[model samples]
Target: MDVSVIGSGYVGTTVAACFADLGHRVVNIDIDEEVVATLEAGEPPIHEAGLPELVATHAGPDSTGRLRATTDYEALLDTDVTFLCLPTPQHADGSIDLSIMEAGAEQLGATLAETGDWHTVVVKSTVVPGSTADVITPAIEEVSGRTAGTDFGIGMNPEFLREGTAVEDFQIPDKVVLGADDERALADMHTVFDPLVDAADAPVVETDTRTAEMIKYANNGFLAAKVSLINDIGNICKEFDIDAYEVADAIGLDDRIGAKFLRSGLGWGGSCFPKDTNAIIHAATEAGYEPAMLKAAVAVNDRQPERFLGLLDEHVGVADRRVAVLGLAFKPGTDDVRNSRAIPVIEGLQARGAEVVAYDPVAVENMRSHFPDIEYASSAAAALEGAHAALAVTGWDEFAALDAAFDTMATPVVIDGRRIIERREGLTYEGLTW
Candidate 1:
C-alpha cells in the first residue's frame, strides 16, 4: 500500500517510519520546511527511542527508499491511504482547539478532490467522541463536494503509542482498533494493519467510528484516574507512617488490580493524560453531567507537587538557599517536557527565594525554553554538588545509582518525588510517599 501521513510531529513521524518498515511505500506531509528536509535526509525531527535508525533504514539514499517526506499536500493525490496526524491541543477552558486538525482536513479534502480515484482517510490523532464523524467529515465534504462514505472513506483509528517506548508499543500493541461503518472502509483499514496484527498476534477490535473515538478517550481517562487514585491512597499512607509501595505490592497481587502505572509519585503529566482528561471533562460538562471522580483525580494530581515541596520545606529553609532539581522530562527515554511535573517544582523553589539548578539526561534544552534564567548542569552529580537540597522529580535510572553523589550536597537533604532514590547512611532522605 502507498500511504501518506500528514503533519510530521511525534505521532506522524513514528507512524511514517513504522509503516515504511512494514513494507509499505510511505510519504510524510508537513508544512515545516525544516522538518521536511530533516525527514528527507533520513533523520527524525523528534527524539524518540529507535526512531532514528528506522528512518535511516527506510528513507534517504542508502536505503530502500520506501519512506519520503514533503512540504506539499498535493503529494496525497498519488497515495491510496492518508492518515491525519495533526495535533489537537487543549484550549484555555479545557475544550480541544481543533483549528489545526480542521485546516489539515480541508487541505486533504482539496487534494483528494483533485484525484479521480478513491482514498481512505484515517484520523490517527486523539480526539473527542464525535470529532471524526461530526467536525472533520463536514469540513472535508464542504470543500471536496463529495460524500464521505461514497466518494471517500473516512475512519477513526486512534494511536496508543507512549512517548519513550513508542516504537516497541506500536510493534507489539495489545489491541488494534479498526473503526468504520462501511465494509469497504473497514477492510481497507484491516489491510493497512494486517502485517502488524500478524506480527504481534494482537486482537482486532471492530467497531463504529464514534465508538472508536470514545475508546481512545476512555482508555487514557481510565489510566489517568487510576494513577491519581493511587496518589491519593499514597498520601493517606504517608500520614499513617506506612510504606505505600508495600501496600501497593500487596494489592497488586489480586488479578483485578494489575501492577501497571501503580507507582505513586509526583502524579501524571504529559501530552496525553492532561489533555485527554480535560477534554473529556469539558465534553461531559457541555452535555450537562459532572464527572466527579475524574475531577477529583485531577485535583489530587495538582496538589502532589505542593506536598513534595512542603516536605522539602520541613527539612530545610528554601529561602536564601541553592536547590538542585533532578530530571526534567515527564519520564525518561524522551526529551518532551510538555506538562512535566518539574515545572511546578521549579516554580515552587523559585517562589520560596531559592536558586534553582536543574539536570536531565536529555530534557535540559527543552526545559530551558520554560526557565531561561535557571542554571542547568551537564550531569546529575554537577547539579547535586554544592546545593543546599536536591529534589528528584523524574524516576530516571541514573538517579537510582547516586550513592556517592548525595554526599556532595552541602546539607545532604534529598526529597524524592518519584521514589527513584535509595536511602543511604549519612544522608537526609525523604520519600514523598514510601
Candidate 2:
C-alpha cells in the first residue's frame, strides 16, 4: 500500500516508519524545510528510543524501496492512504489550535479538487471531538467541491503512542479504533493494519467520526485520572502517615484496577494529558455538560507541581538557596518537554530567587533550549553537588540513584517529587507524599 503521512513530527514520523517497516510504501509530508531536510538526511527531530534506528532501517531504500519523505502536499494526490498526523496544540482558552490540521486538509483538498484522484484520508492526530467532521472535513469539502465519503474516502484513527516507546507502541498497540462512514475505506485500512490487529487481538472498534475523536480524549483523560487518583490517595497517606504505595499495592491486585499508571508522581506532563484533560472538560462545559470529577482531577494534578515547590520553599528557604533539579522530560523514556511539570517548577523556584542546577541524561539539550538561565550539569552527581536542595522532578533512572547523589550534595536536602526516593538514612529527605 502507498501511504502519505502529513506532518512529520513525533507521531507523524513514527507512523511513517512503522507502516514502512510493515511493508508499505510511506511518504511523510511536512511544511518545514529544515525538518524535511533532517529526515531526508536520516535525522529525527525528537529523541524517541528506537525511532532513529527504525527510520534508518526502513526510511531510504528498502528491498523494495518502500519509504520516502517529502515537503510536497501533492504527495497526497498519488497515495492510497493519506494520514493526517499534524499537530493540534492547545489554545489559551483550553481549546485546540487547529490551524495546522486545517492547513493540511485545505492543501490536500485543493490538490484533490484539481486532480480528482479518489484516495483514503486517515486522520491520526490527537484532536477534539467534532474536529474531523466540523472543521477538517468541512474545510476539505468546501475547497474541493466534492463531498467527503463520496469522492474521497475519510477516516479518523487516533494515535496512542507514548513518546519514548513510540516505535514499539506503533506496531503493538492496545487497540485500534477506526472511524469512517465509508465501508470501503474502513476495510482498506484494516487490511493495511491486519498484522497489528491480529498480533494484539485488540478490538478494532468501528465507530462514527465524532466517537473516534472522542476516543483520543477519553483514553488520555482516563490515564490522567488514574495518575491523579493515586496522587490524591497519596495525599490521604500524607494525612495518616501511611504508605500510599502499600495501599495502592493491595488495591491493584484486583484485575479491575490493574496497576499500570497507579504509581504516584508530580502529575502527568507531556504533549498529551494536561491539554487533553482541560480540553475535554472545557469542551464538555461548552456543550452544557460539566464533568465535575474530571475537572477536579485536572485541578488536583495541576496543583501537584506547586505542592512539591512548597516543599522546596520550606526546605531551603527559596529566597537565597541553590536548588538542583533532576530530569526535565515529562517522563523517563523520551526527551520531549512540551508541557513538562518541571518547567513550571523550575520557573517557580527561580521566581523565588533560588539558583537551580538541572540535569537529565537525554533531556539536557532540550531543557537547555528552554532554560538557559539555569545551570546544566555534566552528570546527576554534578547537578546534585553543592546545592541547598535537590528536587527530583522527573523519574529518570539516574535521578533514582538518590544515595550517591545525596552523598555528593552540599546540603543533603533531597525532595522526591515522584516518590522514587526510598527512606534513606543520614540525609535530609523530604518526600512530597510518603
Candidate 3:
C-alpha cells in the first residue's frame, strides 16, 4: 500500500514511520520545512522512544527507500490512502477546534481533484463523534467537487498510539478499528491495515465512522475516569491513614478490576486524556445530556496538584525556601510537557513564594517554555542540592535510585507525588498516596 500522512506532528511522523516499517511505502506530508527536512534526513522531529531507529531504517539516505517526506500536497495524489493526522486542539469551552483538520482536508481534496483514480481519505486524528461525517467529509467534497462514496472514499480510523510507546503500540495493537459507511472506503482501509492485523493478530473492529470517532473518546474517557476514581479513593485512604497501594492491591486481585491505572497520585494529564475527556463532555452537553461522572473526574484531576502541594505545606513552609521539583513531562519515556501535572505543582509552589528548581531527563527544554525564570538543573542531584524541600511529580525510573541526594538538601523534607521515592534515616519523606 502507498500511504501519505498529512501533518508531520507527533502522530503523523510516528504513523508514517511505523507504516513504512510494516512493509508499506509511506510519504509524510507536512507544512513545516524543518520537520520535513528532519524526517528526510532520517532524524525524528519529535522525542519518542524507538522512533529514530524506525525513521533511520526506512527513510533518509543509506536505507530502504520505503519512506520519505515532502512539503507538497501534490505528492499525496500518487498514494492510495491518505491519513489526516492534524491536531484537533480544544476551544475555550473545551469543544474541539477543527480548523486545522478542515484546512488539511480541503487541501487534500483539492489535490485529489487532479487524480482520476479513486483515493481513500482516512481520519486518523481524534475528533468529536459527528466530525467526520458532518465537517470533514463535507470539506473534502466541497473542494474536490466529487461525491464522497463515488469519486473518493472517506473513512475514520482513529489512532490509539500513546506518546511514549507509539511505535510499539502501532506494531502490537490490542485492536484495530476500521470505520466507514461506504463499502469501498471500508475495504480500502482494511487493505491498508491488513499487514498490521496479520502481524499482531489483533482484533479488527468494523463499525460506522461515528462509532469509530466515539470509540476513541470513550476509551480515553473511561481510562481518565478510572484514574480519577482511584485518586478519589486514594484521598479517602489518606484520611483514614491507610496506604492506598495496599487497598489497590487487594481490590486488584478480582478479575473484574484490573491493576492498570491503579496507582493513584496526581491524576491523569497528557495530550489525549484531558482533551478527549473535555471534548466528549462538551459534545454530550451540547446534545442535551450532561455527563456528571465525567465532570466529576475532571474536577478530581484539577484538585490533585493542590492536594499534592498541601502535603508539602504540612512538613514545612516553602515561602522563602528552595524547592526541588523532580520530573516535568506529563509521564516518562517522552518529552511532551503539555498538560503535565507538574505545571500546577510549580504554580502552587510559586504562589507560596518557593524558589523552584526542576529537573527531568528529557523535558527540561520543553518545560522551559512554561517557566522561563525558574531554575532548571542539569541532573536530579543538581536540583536537590542546596534545596529546602523536594517534590517528586513524575515517576521516572531514575528517581527511585537516588539514595544520597537528599543529604545535600538544607531541610531534607521530601514529598513524593508519584511514590517513586523511599523514606530513609536523616530524611523526612511524605508519599502523596502510600
Q: Pick by lDDT: which candidate is best? A: 3
Model 1 C-alpha lDDT per residue in residues 1-434, reported as the tens digit of each score: 99999989999999999999999999999999999999999899999999999999998879889999999899988888899999999999999989999999999888877876888899999989889999999999898988888988988898999999999989999799889967778888988999999999999999988999999989999999999999999999999999999999999888899988789989989899999999999999999999998899899999999999999989999788889999999988899999999999999999999999999999999999999999999999999998999999999999999988888889999999999898889889999987
**lDDT by candidate, in order shown:** 0.93, 0.84, 0.94
lDDT of 2 by residue, 107-152 (tens): 8888888777678888899888889888999888989899887888
- Model 1: residues with Cα > 4 Å off, grouped in runs: none
lDDT, candidate 3, equals: 0.94
Worst 10 residues of 2 by lDDT: 58-67
Candidate 1 similarity to native, TM-score? 0.99
lDDT for position 274 in model 3 = 96
Per TM-score, what order, best first? 3, 1, 2
Model 1 has an lDDT value of 0.93
